[model samples]
Target: MILTLTPNPSVDRTIAVATLTRGVVQRATDSRMDPGGKGINVSRALAVNGTDTVAVLPVGGPQGQVMEDLLRAIALPVETVRISQAIRANVGIVEPDGTTTKVNEQGPRMSADEVAALLAAVDRAAAQGLEWLIGCGSLPPGLDGSFYADLVRRGHAVGAKVAIDSSGAPMAAAVAAGPDLIKPNDEELEELVGRRLATLGDVVEACRTLIAGGVGCVVVSLGGKGAVLVTADQVAHARATITDPLSTVGAGDSLLAGYLHALTHGADPATALRTGVAFGSAAVCLPGTEVPTPADVAKIDVEVVDPVDLDLPL
Candidate 1:
């Protein structure tokens, strides 16, 4: 069973407008709401793809109840820890031109005991037999940067491979702990290594540096340009076949889900990367956090290029 932990989950409200204007009232043409959070998205994607996934998160207040009801309505398997504060709500305004403006809440302020409770919940879930553990998204208020690191350590202790997708100090700390895999978009990758990445060579160098630092594998996702996969022995570049862009939101999460699913199913790294890029590209072709179907992935053209050894500054 795949277990996903979301420290800061939210209710996502998406509104569609013809255009966004500054300091003006714009009527929304349509509105929709769903579970919002990185780990939630990953679990949803996996579940849609026929993978058995359990979404473990902290929920509280009426808003949290609404979020849980929404997930249950969608038939998602969820395990939640009740907290004191209410969960957050994120708003996304999508323009007719396919541009999306997102406003995210910082989420609830978690207490130390609350954080420990969630970790304990993860332990319980692991004891029930977890094949893979995925720690994704940002740390909520009052939580330490090493939160995901702790999860990685615990997952490893339970003989489960851990995959992390996050940013800032949390991501850095998790990488230092050496998760089995990490999916960082181009921007996050640049931030992690403290440098500007302008080319594929730059991305490869960054991945190599992370691997040398003890990360098992690094997947750097480049919007439109596709993704780069780096391990100790090889670095492969996979490009998307479909070029027509719709929405770029949630593409990275979908990619991580696809890749993790493939890896868990015993596919090689190259095959997994190809599947990931395909899912990512397909996601961009759809609207709002919608993941690609296996049929969509099968139709995508993915080309894996030879590893390029570029001299880069560590």
Candidate 2:
């Protein structure tokens, strides 16, 4: 089974309008709400794709209850640690032209005890024999960036592969812990490497640097251009065939879910990259943060190719 941890969860409110005009009254054509968190998104995508997965997150206040109810309605397995602070709510304004503007909250503050309790839950989940442990999203306030690193260490000790999708100090610390896999988009990677990635060669080099830092593999997402997979043995680029534009949000999470699902199911890195690219493309073809179904992924053509010999800064 795949286990995902989301320290900061939220209730996502998506309002659809014809256009977003500042200082003007607007009416929303439609509205939808769902559980919103990186790991939560991954778990939902996995469950929808028929993967056995469970989401572990901290839930508090009325909004937290709403998040839990939404998860239950979808039949997704969730284990929430009750907290004192109310979970945050994110607002997304989607225009008719597919432009999405988002306003996000910083989420609730997590105390030491609450953070400990969440870690305990992760330990319990790991003890239950997890195939993949996904530590994703931002660290809640008052929690150290070493949180994901600790989870990676625990997951490795239990013989479960860990995949991390986070940014900033948490991501840097987790990389040093040597997670089995990391899925960072181009911008995040650039920040980690402290350099400008202007070309595919630059991205490949940055990925290799991360791999050299002890990460087993690195998947650098390149938006609509697809993603790059760098392993100890080879580097491969997977590109998605875009059909139509829908919503780009949560596409990266879908890609990570697909890749993790494939890796845990015994697919090679190349195959996993292809599947991830396809899944991400499918996600972009759907509205809002809704992940694509397996059938939708099957229709996208993902091309994988070997990169030419490139110079390395090492």
Candidate 3:
């Protein structure tokens, strides 16, 4: 079983509009509300695919209640830590061609006691014998970059492998803690490495540096350019052709879910990378933040390349 912890969860409302103008009233073509945050998205995708997973997050106020109701409506297993303030509600505006403009709130400031309670909740969940503990999403106000680093230590103490999907200081600190895996998009990867990674070789070298620093593995998601996976012993690049996509939001989360799902089921790193790309490609074909089911993933074909073309521009 895998346990996911979302530091700043939200009620994500996505609106499909013909066009978005800065100062004009517009009618939405479609809309949807899903449980938001990286870890929550991963858990939701896993549960949809019949994986044993639990989502742990902080919920409070009316928005928090709505978030809880939505999770229950989907029959997702969740463990929520109550906070004093209402969690954030994020908005996404999508066009017909799958271009998304997102407006996200920073979320409420978590007090010292609330932060401790959140970590304690994660510890309790991890103690239930999870195979992996995934710490995801952004930190709420009042939390420092060391938050995910602290979680890595906590997960290791309980004998659970930890994976982190985040950016900025939180990600750097977590890297120093030597997580089992990290899922970062191309932009996030560049930020973490503090350099411009314009080619596939650049990405591999950056990941290798992290591995040298004790990170077990690094998975970099390059939108449309596919994804690259680097370990101490192997490097694989996987991509699937996706045409006329709907939305790109949460695609990376689905990729992480597919990769972990494969790993837990005994697949090798190369096969796992293919599965992740397939899942991500499938997600782009759907609307809003809707996750793809097993059927959706099965229809997509993935290609995994070894000795990747270093000159391929990202």
Candidate 4:
């Protein structure tokens, strides 16, 4: 089973409108609320695909209650740490053309005791054993950046591979600890290496640098251009075309989930990349943070090639 920990989970409310005009009244055409956080999304995607997975997160307040209700509605297995402060709620405004404007809360300021409780909760849940322990999402207020890095060491101690999907200082710290896998989008990759990546070569070079630093593998998602997989001795690029695209939220998480699902099922890295691209591509055709199931992904086709063309523009 795959275990996922989301440091800052949320009730993500997505409102769809024809056009977003500032200083004007607008009525939403549709809206949806989903459990939000990178790791939670990974678990949700996996669960829908018939994969064994568990989600671990902290919860509090009315919004936290809503989060729990949503997870229950989806029949997702979750282990929640009760925190004193309420969890965050995020808002996304999506236009018909697939333009999304987001307003995210900073999340509650967690106490030191609350932080310890969360760590303890993860330990308790992981005691049952898992194949992969994933630490993902942004650091909530008052949480240390080294949190995921600490999880990496803990996962290794328990004989489980660790994967991280986060950004900023927290991600940097986790990378220093050498996680088994990391799924960073092109922009996040640029932020980590502190440079602009204009071509596929730049992404490969940057991923190689991370592999040299002890990271087992790097998966870089390039949005519509597709994704790249880089390891110590392998490089592959995979892409899928999406017609009638809707929302991009949680697509990357679905990609990571697909890759992990395939890898755990004994698929090779290249095949896993193709599977990931298919899942992500399918996700884009759905609305409001919705994840696709096997039926939805099965219709998608992914083209994967090793020895990627470095000259390809990102």
Instruction: Find the 10 residues in a row with the least total lDDT in model 3.
Output: 119-128
Q: Give TM per candidate.
A: 0.93, 0.95, 0.98, 0.98
For residues 131-234, write the lDDT of model 4, one tens digit per residue: 99999899899888899899999999999999999999999999999999999999999999999999999999999999999899999999988999999989
List pairs with backbone clashes in candidate 3.
none
lDDT of 1 by residue, 1-314 (tens): 88999999989887878888989987988887878788888888888888888889999887899998989888988889999999998888887656889999999998878888888888877777888899999888889889889889989998999999999999999999999899999899999999998778888888899999999999988876778898999787788756566567788988888888888789999888988888888887777666788876777787776554344322
Candidate 3 per-residue C-alpha lDDT over 231-281 given as tens digits, one digit per residue, 9 for 90 to 100? 999999999988788999999999999999898889999899999998899
Candidate 4 residue runs with Cα over 4 Å from true position: none
lDDT of each: 0.85, 0.87, 0.92, 0.92
The count of residue-pair clashes in candidate 1 stands at: 0
Give residue 159's error in model 4 in angstroms: 0.7
What lDDT is reached at residue 129 by model 2? 74
The residue pairs found clashing in candidate 2 are none
Cα-based lDDT at residue 291, candidate 1: 71
**lDDT for predicted candidate 4 compared with the true structure:** 0.92
Better of 2 and 4 by TM-score: 4
Model 3, residue 53: distance off in Å is 0.7
